[model samples]
Target: MACISSDSSDLYDVLAGRPRLTGLALAPSDDRLIASVQVINGEGNAFVPGLWEVDPAGEWEARRVTRSLQGEYAPAFAPDGRLMFLSSRENTDPFTRTSSDSTGPGLWSLPEYGEAERIVHHPSGISAFTVAHGAGTVAYTASVLPGAADTAAHAEFREKRESAKITAVLYDSGPTRFGGADLGPAEPHTFVLRPDGTQADVGGQGVVGGGDLALSPDGTLVAYTRAVAGSDPDVNANVVVVADAATGEVRRIFSRPGHHYHRLVFTADGRSLVSQRQRELTYDTPWRVTLVAFDPASGAETDLLPDFDNWPWPGSPVVSPVPGDATVWFTGDERGHCPVFRRGPDGTVTRLTSSGAYSSLCVALDGTTLFALRSTIDSPPDVVRLDAAAPDQQPVTLWAPADPGPLPGTLTEVHTTADDGFPLRAWPVLPRDASAERPAPLVVLPHGGPQMSWSGWTFGFGPWPFAARGYAVLLPDPALSTGYGQRMQERGLGQYGGRPYRDIMMLADATQTRDDIDATRTGLAGHSYGGYIANRAATLTDRFKAIVTYGGQWNLESFQAETDLHAHARRIFGDPLTQRQRYETDSPHLDVRKAMTPMLVVHGGKDYRVPVGQALGLFNDLQRHEVPVKFLYFPDESHSVGAPNHVRILYETVLNFLDHHVLGQEWHRPQLL
Candidate 1:
């Protein structure tokens, strides 16, 4: 292993030089595992996440699977042990494959011991795909231009329009954009790739967007989630349906109001389907969610863990779909630890792993071994293997080819009792040399997604470089954080200003009492929803010497009007016309006159989630009020940034802000600005 420099510059160098592991895949035989590593291509300045074979036997051996300069990802093992994935590589000969010459993702395949070959090219890019466990059938989702019968026809139409220099998107009254969409000019559809390399239409024109699709064990049927056509996708609910793979016959199996379904996975028996269902019973109910199993033939749905007190995470199913194995596995965010659990078919839920966050769960065909990507608050995710039958025993770390170098500091969690009597779990990172005799400055950093928690082991987000710069960082989970029960979320919904704000302040106040933390030199910072709280904190109190907000919103009224998923505004704050008071009360824009501490506002120009206008408008208001503030803008970035140099600049800019204000160091501006 190469030794890493202990200096804080190492943190900056890695953030700017490293590729991130996006996903993981396990062979059916459980002999090997592969992962998708996304790194920035320097020549193009674009993220190119490619597949790599990962060894979990501790040899730390790794081999690159695909060498396409254009990149490949989403690896899956075929029934015959071949690898299949999606690629957007440009074709060498434009005349032979004119359709693939365009900028669209195409399906590619590689035998166990041969070079990869292009299977079929979709005029539009393929988003997600699944391979049948038993029959080896393949199903995938793609975008199709409206009124086009096939990919070639759409390609011709697209070329004609582009040649004529047309750039208008005519629309009706439906939503112009959805929360989870590929942001293409065409509607999404699902198709079955035939064994002979042909294409079979599954959704055709009936489907408007490509939703979650799962193939049955025998490859006879597919269950997928899609919204009803001719409805507003932003506000409409998505339902699940089963379709005959060969006949294209579809059956609507599940639908409910105020509930949206995805992750449509079929059990090994093929008689039932399982989904991570989100049940938002009311507009402000937070979310009462659980895993549900539905008998497609009987049209009966059963809640897997109806009495389970915690949220089971609504994205991907943690349980491995093993034939005759009725146990469901998942991890829930409790107090501070996000623990893994195994639920018996009889509804008995048991804890599997004791602490830390887990992801990319994969189990063997017979359910004997479990592999996942695990991480903690002070570290990023890495490959790990655990006992499938009984995971209470500590898991083993897999061999990693590349090193993440060394951490800049140490992380520790502290508890503080909120005014409501419920204890708050907050993580504080201290510098390596800090002690009672030489206290370090403190920075309160809240995470984004008030609905999200701060339990995982991610090294990049915060504190790493900050602590290395002789500053202490604190991350706290308030009432609205998920994985805790629905009751805790309800207490935070419209009650943001009072509880969430006070809860964060309480944690910072407690840290001040510690002899290792300096009480006078304190800073506050947050991104997204956390940034919203940071904005409110600046106006509500001057306890911190400096504050920073990235991709945050200050005015709920205007934020709701411009946000992509505008309906959430009504769900969280009710109608701006009716519950007018709630929307205005906590908004930092309305209370900017009270702000005194110095602030730094940063935003991505392409952000549609919170909208870039929120930052520009707030920056204007702060400037109008003569508040000490600076706005850092990224023109080519989105809500989240992946470009290596952009990420490095973000960290550098943030650290410089705190260095001058909190540490009283000379302000060093990032050269990229």
Candidate 2:
């Protein structure tokens, strides 16, 4: 059961047709492969996610895992070959629904090709589970704080408070109880289940937050990250702690301030633990990676891959089990694109793949095979397997169903110049069917996270929907993007609407010079920080024919005051009262009346990070100026537009709006005005 996009010439169609399937798991005894698949019909609606099992010979078939749960994620095979996954059941009690207090998440298990049974239930949240090799024991993180029953009420109150300053006494009402009593407190705690279904707390008493728990091959020791609440959340008081499985005796082996240790793994010998520390530095600080190995017995720590000059941003470390060969594998940026690397015991590094395709690597049991999702900027994600021992490992597509057809465009990556001559990266997808004689409409997509950058993926945001309607899409990764070093990220700290806006304008100008683009028919769109940029871009230029923003910030001052972590906001932007000029200059509201582009605003009603007020501020400003605009609010969403139905509606609305403004199509009837 493979999923493929249905729209002809759709960017998703080209990428989804690339044959990448995800959620691959292999059984230890027989080495059979099991994977979870998303099935799509000809109408482009994703049917439910299903579980599939493939024989060693590569023969496979699939069965639906949950009929009731609409969104099922993170499926894995239990040691006994049974399927275990997470799903949220719908709540219908009117009072519960209105009060924002409902509990429905549960850990469910089903026999291989059998019905699903609820194994664990929680009203709060449960995530990141690791099952022992034989399936006799399972370890997972469960939040046991009060107010788990009412997520809506909790969210509403949390939003209203401006700070996450809840009374300390209410922390004990967690959603799940193990061994007859609640874990107590809403903070995340690690728990383990024995063969008989009985559960016990694995972390020592008083351990507040735990993450990335890894069990030893023999199931005797557990390694996890322990985070203690500090006076400030931005300044994390965290350390890597290893605990004994039987006695629950804990020992702290490593500590780092303002740096997070994650992706814990035990070496084959089981004597040492390896972990990756991601260190974030401010504009005035230096960035470093301290990869350390800790001895469980003496509590001594050794630097294996210390702060090297040329280092990759490490993610999800895995260790091989073969004796005399202690190797660690992780994903990092080796040469611009994310790739998998194997660090031998001697500290030598080996690059495994070279297609420059974006890959998320996950290792199998014997360390002989690697499963990954490989994709390019113009390609949809596909699942591929790499033979670790093969001299020339070619990626074989595990799933490539029938395609909707080839896209009408060619996607190309181009290097452009920023305001200060810093090199910027942008991907431009031009219509293959377009000619120099005719001009094609263009859409400038600003990626979310002014801090994050657009990477090696082909389909971005609502670009596919517009591309299917025959518009060229341009995605830019300006100064404040990740993959580039720390300095590049901090460059836009106080220049949100300043240099960043200039860089985007330059990219737009560069795109207009292309033979296949229509300079007259240009539009802008983005979400989060991208939303902020898009709104500001509209005010800065009448060159854009249409503008759309999802969860964008309108007033930086209001955002800083309303957002969580007031302390960090003060640290990042300085006191708004003191830096009033900087805040006003960076905010889109200061120039809202200057906006000339026809605009559409979309927001999740429940978003906390940017909040709905941000969108309302922009919408009200547009209305005050008698500007042509429409606003669509999703009642059941957050910072991200999660629901499939809502996303579909958003895509349709964006396409119609772009068509009217940029393609000379019939104007979309305004919904809000």
Candidate 3:
């Protein structure tokens, strides 16, 4: 795999080899450089971590940062340019009675230019930490027990009984000691750092915690989101609160009864605060990004950008420190694709990059440079830098000295009408070499999250593999997809295998007419909710030539009964017994005898969510009925196949099966019991 720059204009491949860069962090300085690296082997078989420094000229230098630690991650540069990181020391004593002898998470610091040393060690767990902008003080949240024995006991209890209560403590940078002021028994919230080396909790009392806390440039006021308890499926979180750092007095500046306050930032002059709010929902709730301005003196709120769709799922909003300007930078979704956007004082939105497949973005201290992580289906993630001041400037790749494989085909937006005339959105990825004369086979790839929408991104299974192998892929985001609005997501409730199934079939029908798609050799694949769709599609229609399910549920009844998150399922679906008709109608087991498509069922043996028994039940039914079916079980894998070797084998096996059934091409067959 190779690294591809984010700027479409300067699209050039960098790095050429098997080792793929997996993680990246950019320095705060506007030097267009990255501070860390996570690499994966060429076959995507192994993951290795190291620290690196990449200069503006695209030069790379890497060194092993933590040799004594087993697993290290979440590295950040301190105010004084020192590297602060989290690492878990290897605990070989299987029978150790003390937490110190058992594995524990610790925080360590190293000169941004030197060797690493222990900073703070928590016998229980260190959840998070933040360094003051220029104060060189570190404020962190940690869960600690009374003693080593108690820590060990809590760990064992969490493993065996699945229940353990740990105390969360907030501490300022000081000499090593396990004691501090108790933040609370509840989850640790975001800590706002003050310039004077003091930190305050932004989250108040409640289960509906806080996220994305932003402090003003002068560090006078802090803005954060607060969710109200018992508000499910409602997009609007309760309120956006602003607190005075000096007095610790807080005021609720903005409130949306059912929508969530997603992101917050103060204006350039600190005269007003801007925040993004969206309606909250349990399943698929469509979200809209609205910007609100708050007055500091009177606690008055006003809408700055009422129609600002650019902040869809907006997060990490940062107001520039430069004077005489009121611009804010944030990342949000546009038409199902997430992109980084910079909003000018006049409310003009400038898209920073063409590629919408990005998880995070951060602006440098100068506020003129932007560092982002971008990825797509065929490409692994890499950090890239963009000059925010010059929108037309080219992007520079900062990690992974290789070219990403060819773009995983081309995705085109599609819409199909369900039985009720409701339009569903979908994306069809056509084969790279597809043409009217030599049409490719079709793969109907239903998305998981029957509640979550399939946002356009580079790759994560689905039709990407099939399309890469000369097949066309159709991905349908049925009524249950979020971001379309609350009404659309609520359509999935008590209607699984109903409207959602019809939506997928309609998408398949629309794809069959594509000049580069062959309807006769179509297939279906999905995981989780998608797995359920795959099984249901095979049983409901003979249009598919083959089907694959990854850790998918076969029987909704068994799923509700066996899943570890039974409480969540119960809340989402109500009482299963009362919704017996919906469960029966949705279960693939009910119509397994009707399944004619050659099916491959894959499951991780340790998956407790969609238990392996779900796959086993479907496989057993197919076997009893003499259906052409295969089952592959990974003993050490879980709901997700995390091991590199297992992942490679799984993909190979799936491709081989698809080749044989969908393309009528002979391929090596893996042994399936």
Please, what is the TM-score per model? 0.95, 0.81, 0.73
Q: Compared with the true structure, what per-residue lDDT tens digits does model 3 show for residues 1-673?
A: 3433332212211212233444444544544343445455455445555555556545654435555425466666665566777666553334533444335556677675566665554445565554434345444444322221333453454444323443334333211121112223233344444545444444442333433455554566666555444444233346676776555478555675555565566665667777765554333333344566677778786665556543235655666656557777766544455567788888887777665555556666667877776655445666677777654344677654445555547878777677877666778888667888898888787877665556544323545545556778887777666556545655666667777888888888887878788878888888888898888887888878899988888887778776765444554455676756666677789888788888999998878777889999999999898889998899866677765556556766887888898888886775542
Q: Write down the worst ten-residue block by lDDT for model 2.
A: 172-181
lDDT string, candidate 2, 1-673, tens digits = 2432334334444444333345566565535555556654344544455555554434464333455535555666666777677666554434434333335455677685556666765445565666655334667776543343333443454444435664333342222222112334455667776668777666631234444776665667767777554344347636777776655567554765566677777776677788877665432343445566777888887766654333335556667756456777766543236666677788876667665453546567677877666665555555567765443246766643334345556777667777787777677877665668876788998888665555555333645566667788887777565556545645666676887778778888888888888888888988888898888887888888889898888888888776643444555566777767667777778887788788999888777677789889899899999989899888767787744445566776887888887777997654532
Give stretches of model 1 more than 4 Å off. 1-7, 56-60, 92-96, 178-184, 204-211, 229-236, 312-315, 318-321
For each of the candidates, the C-alpha root-mean-square deviation to the true structure, in angstroms, is 2.4, 6.9, 8.0
Candidates sorted on lDDT, descending: 1, 2, 3
Q: For model 3, what is the alpha-carbon lDDT of residue 249?
A: 71
Q: Write the per-residue lDDT of candidate 1 for residues 38-103, one digit (tens) a residue.
A: 776866366787988887565766788888778998888887788888898866543557633666
lDDT of each: 0.76, 0.65, 0.62
**TM-score leader:** 1
Error of 3 at 336 (Å): 5.7
